[model samples]
Target chain A: MDHSGISVLFEGTNFERLLGGLWVTVKIAAVALIVGLILGIILGVLRTFKNRPLRVLLRLYLEFFRIVPTVVLLFLFYYILPRQLNFNLPGDQLATLVFALWVAAEMSDIVRGALISVPQHQRESGKAIGLNRYQLYRYVLIPQAISLEIPATINLATRVIKTTSLLMLISVMDVINIGQQIIEANNHTHPTGVFWVYGLIFLFYFLIDYPLSWWAKRLEKKRLERANG
Target chain B: MKKKSFTRIIAAVSVFAALLLVLTGCGNAKKSSSQSNNPSSVQQIKKNGTIRIAVFGDLPPYGWVNKDGKRVGYDVTLAHQVAKDLGVKVKFVQVNANNRVDALNSNKVDLVLANFTVTPERKQVIDFAKPYMKVSVGVVSPKNKAITKASQLKGKNLIVTKGTTAENYFTSKQPNVNLLKFDSKTQQFNALKNGRGVALADDNSYLYAWSKDNPSYTVGIKSIGPKSYISPAVKKGNKSLLNWTNKEINKLTKQRFFVKDYNTQLKPYFGKEVKPSDIVLPVK
Candidate 1:
């Protein structure tokens, strides 16, 4: 209703500040997703090992992270970790670490589900061709598992992007935090600013997440097509 | 079949657009109707038999929600007194520092008593009552890394609550300092305790109270920047309410109401080191 209030986002350094905040969010998400992917693959593969104690321990690790909320984990890592361990870490670094652990847990579950979903005959067929254990996994099982993992991983990446908004709570100058600052600074002059300020935040998040969602959908469709063909 | 599906999609989109327009139109209509009424005038508030005052719900000693879920703090008590003096029922709207002014401007509340510091920039948009309390920016840090002077803050990390005078002051005057701004008092203190910054700058009362509770930290710099007064703000051009509130503040000041407020609400938290006389504005 108040175009003037919304116009402030376009004026002066406000838009630039918002973009800087967005960059911070993107950087955090990107780092977390990459690190989590690597760690998750290891954990997922380890869980599939024949060692019973190791599998049980990995299961506990996954369940612990999956059960606790991200915000709680953030607080635990940011607040409790430093005092308990006598080591200081920046809030953004702590947030990324916590998010990565969370992603690792979720990704492990996705990988494990995909690995188990592969047909037993497929692995046997790879071995029938005289492929070694590692070669069988590389040439046969992993390729098939990757097709199953791609869409879910993209969906998880979107979740990481959405979760970066919580970084504002711990004083990380992410996009949502900067949006709050802009609204706080101008709200006195613009009474109707809450609507437009928050609306812009919604738009920024959608612009980022919507494409990821679309890509996930496209990947899923392609997987379906390949399966049919 | 393809044409029929295309027609269905078009019809669905049009219906969704119409629904969105109707919803937004209803919201605009309600806002306009409330604006037209303008029930913030003193006489109108009296006629309506109720006054809504916005105060911070998280900033302890100033305004906070008690464990019992009732609003109990210095500003809340003062707001209740104001309503009682006007023979009107009081409704307390909880607001954070960022949204307090907007709460008044948007007519969501008739008055804001959320430890709002009076400044020229804010004066352009909202009208402040006569000063009720005065406070200066103070700095707190770990005793081992105490910073007594402004010069020490150079290249040092300082934590400040966003939208506060401390943030604005350091941003303009001490641009070289790394200022970490948080949204609430709790987060600012958490950042300080978590070793996010070397010093935390905020209102003297808040820093004083916090340092008193946490022995590891001390108030290194007692004052920074010019003294600012905390006053209740009304929407700009609300002459009737502005005049009435100013008169009420003056009357209450003479009664030493703030002295009682300081003793009851703040003394327990800030300790005996913080004097009531030093912070409460003199009656004028």
Candidate 2:
């Protein structure tokens, strides 16, 4: 409500900083979604392998990431991974990498489910034509599996965007980080400006993730239409 | 049917590849953001006639939101003065402890006033102005089971805000103390109040402030370990700004402006327990 302190947010480099941070959030989400999809497909396919060891290992990987909290996983990246694994990455890059790995693990289960949902008759028909295993997957099974996974994939992508805000803990200057920066800078003079500022931040995130949600839903409807037609 | 499916597969892969390219381009664009040196180049600031400042908004008493939803605290007080002394219209920017250094280095802020502590490790990365507040490390405990000595903290759960001097000191010296560190003091205080830990360790001023609002909690001890000073921080190699700030501190110290500052900003939380002289360091 205090227009004076909160108004600074709209003017000069402060607003630019917020946009910069939003860009970081977008970058992290995009990178993580892509990496997650690729890794998830590999893991998902491995889960179907006849070898008991590989399937079991893939299942364990899927379970571990699913059970652990994303923030704790992020901590593992920020603190333990570098010291133990010697992966000395910058904070923002580390956040993107870790979130991608987490998303991939979660997404693997979605991929596995979608793959299983593809009818056995389809694979049988491909085999009747003497199609190679790789060609069968590339031509017949994977595309249908992905189309089924689209809705879940969009859900997972939004989750990555929401979770990227947690990277503020490790000092990654994302959108929430900019909000914190603005609040701190103005607190002394504005004293009551944080509510408006943080309130506006909620709006900023809503503006981004909500549209993605709508687009995903619209795409889901189109897929349903094509399936019916 | 087989040809149609193969075409679909190729299309999907190509679309996926295009998405990857666009995202990679986005990442590169962010990483290579234009290096705007306006704030860092203080020479330009002198010409512009304004200095930008960044402080924490959610940190109470030091920097936090008040009831009407505005940021207010001790750091904000000095920040306004520093800008005034610079003869530039002050532009306050919000930042937290985590983003303080980056905000400064990125030229988003001219100075950092976010309850920043003067630590040797941090001094290496950023130049610090003269210390304005005396910040001694202390602990808060439930009145029922108070801890009066630093040695009492050994082997007990000590909740501290992560990335603070409290965590640093305890981790370095009191290794046996089980640290349940949180990112915010609100959480640390909650842990202490909820009986999740025996005590919470942080700056004396914060403990004193907490004790005032909640009489049930008491600060069992005063200061422990090597004393720490709180000061505004600026980016390294800003000698012009640093020297100007040092002179301003000297003027404020001579004018008893610091006493006024302490009385206005800190006295409410401190009450009559801590003498003014105890807080006011000898001008050196």
lDDT by residue (B188-211, candidate 2, tens digit) is 877888898998888887778668
Give per-residue lDDT, candidate 2, residue B207: 79
On TM-score, the leading prediction is: 2
Q: State which docking tier applies to candidate 1.
A: incorrect
Write candidate 1's Cα lDDT for B32-79 as tens digits: 456445559988899889998887655667776442345678898899
TM-score: model 2 vs. ground truth: 0.54
What DockQ was computed for model 1? 0.02
Give the per-residue lDDT of model 2 (tens digit) for A146-218.
8898888888888788888888766577888767757755654565667877787788888888988998898
Chain A TM-scores of each predicted structure, in the order given, are 0.95, 0.91
Model 2, residue A25: C-alpha shift (Å): 1.1
lDDT of 1 by residue, A1-229 (tens): 3457877676557777778889999999999999889878767765665669868987998999989888778766655554343333455776787888889888988888888778999988888988765566668877899999989999999999998988765546788876766665454346477688788888999999999999899989999998999
Q: Where does candidate 2 chain A have its weakest 10-residue lDDT segment? A: A80-89
Q: Would you list the C-alpha lDDT of every candidate in the order shown? A: 0.80, 0.75
